[model samples]
Target: MDEGINSSTPAWLTEEFIEAILREDEKTQHLQVARADVQPAVAKGDNFGGLLHRVTAEIYYQNNGNNQEKSELRCIIVKSLPSDDWYREVLDQAGVFKREMRMYKVILPAMYKLLKEKLPGVTIPALTARTYTSSITNETLVLEDLRPLGYRMVDRRQQLDLEHCVVALRALAQFHALSVALNDRDPSLMDHFREGFYTPERRHILSPFLQPTLDTLASAVEKWPEYERFGDKIRQIAATSVDRIIDVVKPKNNSLCVLNHGDFWINNILFRYHPKNGKVLGAKFVDFQVSRYSSPALDLQYFIYTSAKEDVRDKSLRHLLQEYHASLTHTLQLLGCGKYAITFGELEQEMKERAFFGLITACTYLGAVLADPSEVVDLDSNFGEESRKNGGQSPMEKAYAGERFRKIFRKFLIHFENEGLL
Candidate 1:
């Protein structure tokens, strides 16, 4: 509470806005949010990951309408577009900023309402969000900060261990399950979500960044004996990556095209651990900037390839699939949906078929994942003018190269090849 609530507040987070929300409740009539302190929430490695800032508020009041005074603290996180014109344009074209606002304001709330009505006890974490879109190019997302609940991110610089993987998968399954039941209750419930994100506008913006990474990755692997066998296929996959992602976005064979957390990488997940033993107790997701309606397998593949190392993935892949399917089915049934038409086999088939989803994403992002926090390049800087000029390679592309990368990339590719994805 001692932190200064100064004039440094961002334009989007005004005192009137904060007071209106705080006093919206009757109990707050006896109190006032005197001031709000804004703090930087950016991690060292994520200087520009989501352009988020934290707002902490101090509330003051008199007890029993008397002279006795009291105070309390409240906090929320704000996500806004980067200050860069280029970054703002990219996010607007891709509808990334708007899509995330929709996710928090529309999709997540709707899904929660459906679950509450259909299944009594079954629930997931609740997200409290308010959005301010000042213009088409300027947007902000104020979300419930999970840190107050002792939730912390599992290290992204290293692969997740078994407990972390299991907790994340089970939690994701619960979320996916909510989508399943909601969709079954109303087949068109997710029609808006199905808009999909790989539009031509997005592709045009993303291609520059993607192409350079692929070329750099290809160049790095060409000399490595481990990837030499699959280098052409790898390069080909990289070159045509965007189109492949777009093609498979359309649902097939009665797949609900379940709501997918389009970016399910470690950076977007948080866990609350038991204080004494330090074991994971709860998990939740953040950053719906890329959420869309697509085959649930897209999320599954993305999560596995991005988070787990070789052994955990190799030995426990199917088991993880089973756990997810079980949670999904259990949730669907709880909503009184009949005859789970989507079976474990169907999910497995999709996983096998969409193996490249994870392969490409992991190959593209793993380097960034493993990078040293201090050495990590800012997102805007990483994809800045220099990269656009040099055919898409940035310091990020350089980070994506080297021995550690080759080892992890080789394992993922070899696994995909054995599974016939190559």
Candidate 2:
């Protein structure tokens, strides 16, 4: 029996199967296993995909006497759910393990295989191992870590030049086009794979977080008299927008619903530089825990709002949308789905309607939470606990956060006025 295999493996994962997988890797021999201290790592940021507890360690092959033939190997990541009680609750409530297993094991692999077979130049993460231990609360996925490929994570506030945006948009267009082509070629396969992934119910799961944040925003907006006229508009939209957003995305019969990197924000994307010119070579996406079947517009809206800075958001909006449409059209033609995929006009209409979804939600909800100084429970003693308590952001930080919120909000309202859609 493989050291990690047990009867408790989910039905989708079996002991015979796990042993076969471990056998394929002959380089490493298991030595000792230990748990990692995860608190320091957690302090880094709250946004690194899933919530992790302590990290688990698996010590493998080592070499000795002659240094020429020797190497030490170990794999470490925050302990997954199967090993931690805290994470188990999180996985249970979110159903993270089961849902992601389906995505990684079935959907993503199929997509990668198809893309590799058709367009070899396209880049995507290569799946490695998917192992589940019932005893531990979390599932362990050994994947090709892209960090080794010279990809680095970027902060949302970092500004991207036009060239970088264009490259990324082209990649996104190809990704969406691949899905459109797959659906057109075999509608049944697309339906079967995407059925459970895209539903209105997922929105409800997010409501607990959304509703409170909206209420908080509603309170904060009262202080800004300049925004008073728009207050009711924001409130009305915030209250019912979750369901409306979902309704807007519900597909209408083989409409180009693709595998979207559900959280297409800056952090989830990794970028690398070219060796000679030091220019951004390309970007690779990761953290697929939120991967779902939704209109490509969802990803577009998210990428624009979270990835682009204020100037880009304000000045380059139309240009970026046009760029995305062009990329989509080109990729569809390459994949032979041009006839079935959406036209530039249709994409524009959808973007106009749905572009505000992420912006509105983030501003009205996240804005309030981020602006509130009390949210930061701890900081260096130099910052002073009293100053850091309950919406403790510095005045400058709060102002910047507020400005971002208002900018997006004002744009949406002005757009509604111009389009006669409000």
Best by TM-score: 1
Q: For candidate 2, report its TM-score.
A: 0.70
Per-residue CA lDDT of candidate 1, range 1-422, in tens?
Answer: 22544344456566666655556533355666777877777565653435677878777775686632667887777677876567777767667776777777667777789878876786556532334322223366666677887887877767788888888888887787777766767766576666446665468765766766776777767778756767676777777888787666667766646778888878788888999999988787888877777788989888887787668887988888888888777767776764644788888888877777777777677777777754465666655666456655365655665556667777777777886766
Tell me the TM-score of model 1.
0.86
- Where does candidate 2 stray beyond 4 Å? 1-49, 52-68, 72-94, 119-138, 159-161, 184-207, 364-422
- Clashing pairs counted in every model: 0, 17
Instruction: List TM-score per model, in order.
Output: 0.86, 0.70
lDDT of 2 by residue, 1-98 (tens): 23443333333343333332333434233332221122222332334334333222333333452232333332222223442343354345555555
- Runs of candidate 1 with Cα error greater than 4 angstroms are 1-21, 24-31, 47-49, 62-68, 121-138, 225-231, 385-395
For model 2, where is the 10-residue window of minimal lDDT?
Answer: 32-41
